[model samples]
Target: MTGIFQANRALLFFLTLAVLIALSSVVVVDENEQVVIERLGQPVRVINRFNPTGASGAGVVLKLPFIEQAVHLGRGLKGYSAGAQKVRSADGQDLLVDTDVTYRIIDPVRLVARLGSTAKLDAELASALPAMLGARLGPLSAAAIALPGNGGAAQLLRGDLDARARDLGVQVIDLRIGRVMPGETALQMTYEIMQARHLREVDAISAEQIASARQTRAQVAAQAAAILQDSAGKDPEFYDFFRAMRSYTYVFENPDAKNPPTIVIPPNSSYLRHFNGQ
Candidate 1:
């Protein structure tokens, strides 16, 4: 009975030791993660979602128990918005600029060597990006930066930033200027200038329309005069009679006038002869 008890105790001890070793030696990496194995604080290898064979490294990975340490990092695109920063425009105008960047770690080994950790990387970017933007944008006018789309300063900064970020093992997918707000004084001045320009345009359009209307009125009056002259040439007596009748109607149609106008006229007057049957 004592020998059987000793054998069972030894088996339990060995089983416990084996389980501890297995747990320490195994590393599990997810599909969206990259792991860096370091031996004695020195980087040994990088196991990521994509290997040289194009296979995912998403299962139990073997490492030396108690010797190798694994550091996991997310393998996904990261976005950083560097909120409003004060910058000077080329025209010597002070403005606030907001910016954003999208990037991904292309080489984890290089990233670990240079930046050490994601927090450190973020700090570096926060310091570096605004300085870069200010330097590049400082030579441009407020109007240029405030215009829509990627401005000239932003484009230049994007190229320069991408080049600089390459050293940190990151690929800058996009860099953009989100907003540009001018100072209060500049904003008021710009508004006034725009208003003045719009007023000038409106005045010009009104002047053109008035000139066109005057020309059309002159043309219509000339046409009416020519038609009247043609009718007079065809029959002078009838035209004279029609003229006398029109004058009589104008002088008599006034609501305040009596049956005949108060003005006196000779009985043989050509205007009054229209009322005579002959």
Candidate 2:
């Protein structure tokens, strides 16, 4: 009877231990989500990653208990709202815009290496989307964008944004844009317009500085010409030697040395009189 009781206790202990191990090691990857298994902070493998070829890595996956971590990423398309953004048009018009981006993690390993998690990805797009809008829509006609149906703004943004999204390990599937006015976006646009005016003032100042620089260069060149004339008046032979030295300097110190002059001078040419001690 004592031996039987001991055997039953040992069996129960083994069963409980197995259940605990199973619980720790089991990972469930949903149809809409992908799981990245990491061992000691390094990604080991991705499960249920996006596969258009129909080899979706969904279903139950196992990882080393206590040694590996599982990170969840959406296998399907995920939508990101960039909120209201203010843009400066080519005609110096400030526009308030709202946009939504549809994206999916194309490379899980790269996404993990760069952004770590989807939350980080969201934070990145939140910051980057506005800047992208400024660059893309700024050069386009503001009047057109303000017209009906937002002037196909989504198509324009999606095309370029998708190309840029490749670096972020994401594929931009779609983009939706609308002209937003009279709210937080309007206030932001007001601030941007004021900043633009300030930038124009600064540009005016820069133009004045550039004109002053050109005048200074012209004055210096005139002074140099006077010096050369004075040297010519001193001695005719000395002037010739001096001129030849300057010519030599110009020839040897050519700015376009990569394509240096190819003309060949004869040994007894008049150009070599100074070198010949004449």
Candidate 3:
């Protein structure tokens, strides 16, 4: 009975050990995840939804407990903002460009073998992406990159980067240019040029307004002269009387005149007839 009890205890211990090892060996890869199994620091297999090894699409992979490791990477698209970088344009203008890249790990085995970790991959990209961007953008003028509706330069940049990044086991989905700004000197020059253009526009508008005002003044003067001529033609005597009255009012009521001119006229003159109630 004692020997049988000892044997049963030994069996229980082995079972517990086996259970621990089994639990450690089993890897559950979710639908959105891809796992790279490495044996002794070398990648052996990648299990993902595309390469489903189980019924539920949640890949259940197994590896040796102490000799293998599972590296889980997201199969979903990942975004990395490369941040702002200084690049020179073809027209010799320095531009500060903010950019981002969207990519996915296309070949997990190659990615594991090359970069080893996402952090290392990111580091590699951070260095290589900007260089690639600069290379593509170097041939583009500042206006080409800074223009609002033009996307050809950016598309070219994405194409070049995608081609280059594929070697790193990443498939570039999209590349975006968030902001493109000129350097300090270039910005100031642009502002000055814009200001000069606005000033010229304002001057042209002002000149046009002045010419319009002169034309309106000439038209009004011609109209007034025509009306006066028509009135004079209608009644010559009344026109003379009105002119005399206007001259009299101007001479007497001229506030700015320092001295009044004395006019000698005969007592029976027509100019004095109205004042004399004749």
Candidate 4:
């Protein structure tokens, strides 16, 4: 019985020791982050916590148990550090612009020291970005803000953001202008201008069509009048002969009829002289 009790005690002690070792030796690294293990406040191991099984550049690493703790860092494109801002143009036009920024962890040490975490950096960017954009855009006109520079608003905005975010530890790779809208007065003015231009274009087209139609009608009437005048001028005798033939057609249709067309005959009528043989 004494030997059995000693054996049971040893087994219990070994099991306890195994449990402690298992608990203390485990470490977890997420897929989209990195870990910096510190030993007594000093960096002892840097574990890239981004994609443990993605590639083989830095394999899954281990550290001494209970001697160090890991600090996580971002591995891929994190969110912007800034929020949206409202700015006014040189023309006193108010514009609300939402910008999205793209960045990565370039200097982890500086990033950690400055922002403490990816979330903090994102917040800082969100706040700082609007101010920077507003400051730069303040002196610009409405046309300038809406159209940007010769390269376009996007290029101008990108250059401006790149210049501003240089010292913020995270590089501003790209910025997007999410939404653009005009204020009440400006929109009204724009509508009025468009309407005026449309009315002018319509009037011009209508006037052109009216003038063209009038000119075509005048030319047709003038051509008809000219043809009649030319025929009278070229053959006066034929004109008279045609008139006589028309009158004869009406009068001769009813011979010896009273109230017939009275065509006055001259004293030297050729038909009467031939019949008398004089």
Candidate 5:
């Protein structure tokens, strides 16, 4: 009975020891997170890291027990709010812009190497927004920067964010501009300046149109005078008859003829010769 009892005790102890070792060497990684194995404070490898064109690494991973530590970082989408930052426009107008960015870890290896964790990355991201916004929006116009729906500045801000986030081992999926506000006094001044510029443009266009109209009228008058002169040179008598006919038609048909004089001439007068056929 004592031998049987000793053998069973030995077997149970061995089984328990094996289970502890197994549990220590194995780590379960989830689909929404990546694990980085660090050996003595140096990153040795990563598991379940983001891959755009390959299978996911989320599952059970074997690690050397007691010698390695796994640092978990979020592989899911994360949002960072840059809040309202102050920047100057191209015209030296100060503006406040609030923006938000969404990103995901694409290269966990690089992320582990640079910041090591998401919390640190978040802090770093918070500090980087001002410079990024200032660089892109500082050269834009006041109206574009101050206005909420400015697409140009939004596009520029996107490009700047993409460039800035490249070294952070993440991909910026979306960017949003929440608000773009300018000071009340500055906004009024900017509007006045813009209005003045537009009015000047309208005045210049109107002046050009008037000058073109006057030039066209002068051309038409010159053309008509040349036609009349040619007609008189070709047939002087016919031209005289035509002029007399035009004068009689105007005196009778022109309701608004200016200060028409009374006529008291004979029926066979020179002015009536064309009509009287004498």
Candidate 6:
């Protein structure tokens, strides 16, 4: 029994030693990340330097567990929202705009030196992008900022970003006006005013057309009446005959049958007197 107890104690001691050895080192690099192995907080090895496609040099990357450290650098595109901001237009219109910035760790060394970590980069975006967009876009009128025309607003903003983004170590490939609308409580009022203006224009055009048509109709009718009057005055006999024909048509086609229709005679009674041969 004494020999068995001694053997068990020895086995327990070796198992504890093995567990300690395993805990002394760790590797958390994924296939999409580049691992920087550091000793005493200083970079010693950079694995997967060129490409992030495969798990190259991705084994039990040994390190003194508590003394050594490893940082996995992200190797692809990442994005963050800059949140909504009230940007003013050249015409003093308040526009709430949001921006999304897409950037990548191009130079890991520079990124580590400048930003220290990916979390730091994200934290910096909130403050950085708003200042950039606001400084670039503010003091423009709503029409200019929102680009009331075809695509002028976006072109203007792109030019601004292109000129300035290089200093930030990130390329601003594109920025867009996501949503632009009136940001006041009187939005409905503004809409109604715009509608009223359009409706007034339409009504003015309609009224002008109506007046023009009326003038044309009146002139044509008056001209036709004058022509008929002149022709009738020149030819009295035919005029009298046509007058009698018109009177006959009016009397015969009158719809009311309540009383017998009578053709009132003039003082000379020229139509019937001429027909009677005196």
| Candidates 2 and 6, the one with greater lDDT | 2
Residue-wise C-alpha lDDT for candidate 2, range 1-278, written one tens digit per residue:
88898879989899999998889899988988888898998998889888998687688888888899899888888988866587777776666788888898899888887888887887877766776787667776777667655566667778778877787789999888755554455578889999999999999999999999999999999998898788788777788888889888877787666888655889899999988877
Report the Cα lDDT for candidate 2.
Answer: 0.81
Q: Model 6, poorest ten-residue lDDT window? A: 162-171
RMSD of each predicted structure: 8.8, 20.0, 8.1, 12.5, 13.0, 9.3
**Which sections of candidate 1 miss by over 4 Å?**
1-15, 49-55, 183-278
Candidate 5 C-alpha lDDT tens digits along 184-261? 667899899999999999999999999999999999999988988999999898788878888887777755668655
Positional deviation of residue 43's Cα in model 4 after best superposition, in angstroms: 3.3
lDDT of 4 by residue, 1-278 (tens): 98898879989899998877666565566666766676766665556633425652244556666776656787777655233367787788977666667766655555555655566666666656666666677787766666634125555677666655556555666766665567666678989999999999999999999999999999998997787578779988556565556656776888778866666778688534433453
Selected candidate, larger TM-score, 1 vs 2: 1
Screening candidate 3 with a backbone cut-off below 3 angstroms (N, C-alpha, C), the clashing residue pairs are none
List the pairs of residues colliding in candidate 1: none
lDDT of 6: 0.66
Clashing pairs in 5: none
Error of 3 at 9 (Å): 8.8
- Give all candidates' CA lDDT scores: 0.82, 0.81, 0.81, 0.66, 0.81, 0.66
Tens-digit lDDT track for model 3 on 1-278?
A: 88898879989899999999999889988888888889999988778733334433466777889899988877878988876688899999999888888888878887778878676877776777777777878888888887752346667777877777788788888887878888888889999999999999999999999999999999999998898799999998777787889889887876667786778989999889878875
Please, what are the lDDT tens digits per residue for candidate 1 over residues 118-224?
Answer: 76776777778868877888877878888875366777787877888889887788888988888777789999999999999999999999999999999999998
The estimated TM-scores of all candidates read 0.59, 0.57, 0.59, 0.52, 0.56, 0.53
Report how far residue 35 has shifted in candidate 3, in Å: 0.7
Once fitted onto the true fold, the runs of candidate 3 whose alpha carbons sit more than 4 angstroms away are 1-16, 49-56, 148-151, 187-278
